[model samples]
Target: MINISEIANEKIKEMLAAEETPNLFLRIGVKEGGCSGFSYGMGFDDEQHEDDKVIEYSGLKVVVDSDSLKYLNGLEIDFKESAMGGGFTINNPNASATCGCGSSFRTATEAGNPAADPC
Candidate 1:
């Protein structure tokens, strides 16, 4: 399970209001290609695959695939707004190392293995 802040809830609500249709959920996953080994991905989703792990939060649904969930079991999704504007941020306790951009990260045992990357 992951933690969601009230700020995050507000951001998601804004996104939900902007959509033309309802039933859109946020999909969080990890992929590759950074100085570190893995990168986090987030998108508005309207579909759920067979292997997805679905969790509901504040009338919103968060979905994660089985493989991606393994690496993000207890992560938190945060909404941050600063001089850089606003965006969804990730707080991953399992990460031992992260790149300067804060997009890619690596665990203690993995180095440069880029999550879900074909390369």
Candidate 2:
């Protein structure tokens, strides 16, 4: 299960309020081709595909596809507000390496595996 901090909930709420769709979720996934060979993908999704493991926290829906769930399960998500500005950050114990930009990551076992970005 993934945990979401209060800050993360607030940020998600703000995003949800701005969306016109009634059904939405914070969708997380992985893609290839960051400096680290794989990168994290995060965004708002309104649809849930078959085989997605959906979790709810603070009235917000969070979805992880079956494939990405292995790499993202047990993650702790929070909203960070520092001099660098504000954004949602994922503390993933599964990540073996992170890119220089800090936005990309790859797991030890899955490193170098090519998974194209859907976006």
Candidate 3:
């Protein structure tokens, strides 16, 4: 299961409210090609696929594709604010190793496709 922290939830709600597009929901997924072999993808999407797995948190809809569900199970999302700026943070339990930027990771059994360029 995926978990969204209270702070992240509030931040996501605010962002969603600011969007001009209607019916936008959060979409999270894993993609190949990163410094660590796999990268994470997260954004607002209006489209849904047949193989999507949907979960709701306090009225906010979160969707994950079947292919990425295995890599994102037990994932934790949070938001942190600093003097410079604020951003969302991800904690993935399924990742065996993560890159320095924390946006890329590799699982114990899978290495995906790593990019030659650094993140």
- Best-matching candidate per TM-score: 3
> By lDDT, who's the top model here?
3
TM-score of each: 0.84, 0.84, 0.92
**Cα miss at 100, model 3 (Å)?**
0.6
Local accuracy by lDDT, each model: 0.80, 0.79, 0.91
Give candidate 3 regions above 4 Å deviation: 111-119
Per-model clash counts, in order, read 1, 0, 0
- Predicted structure 1: lDDT: 0.80
TM-score, prediction 3: 0.92
> What does candidate 3's lDDT look like per residue over 1-119, in tens digits?
99999989999999999999999999999998788878999999999999999999988899999999999999999999999899999999998888888898888776444443344
CA deviation > 4 Å runs, candidate 1: 112-119
Using TM-score as the yardstick, the better of models 2 and 3 is 3
Please give, for residues 42-87, the per-residue lDDT of candidate 2 as tens digits: 8998888999988878788888888888777788889999897988
Worst 10 residues of 2 by lDDT: 110-119
Clashing pairs for model 1 are 37-114
Regions of model 2 farther than 4 Å from truth: 110-119
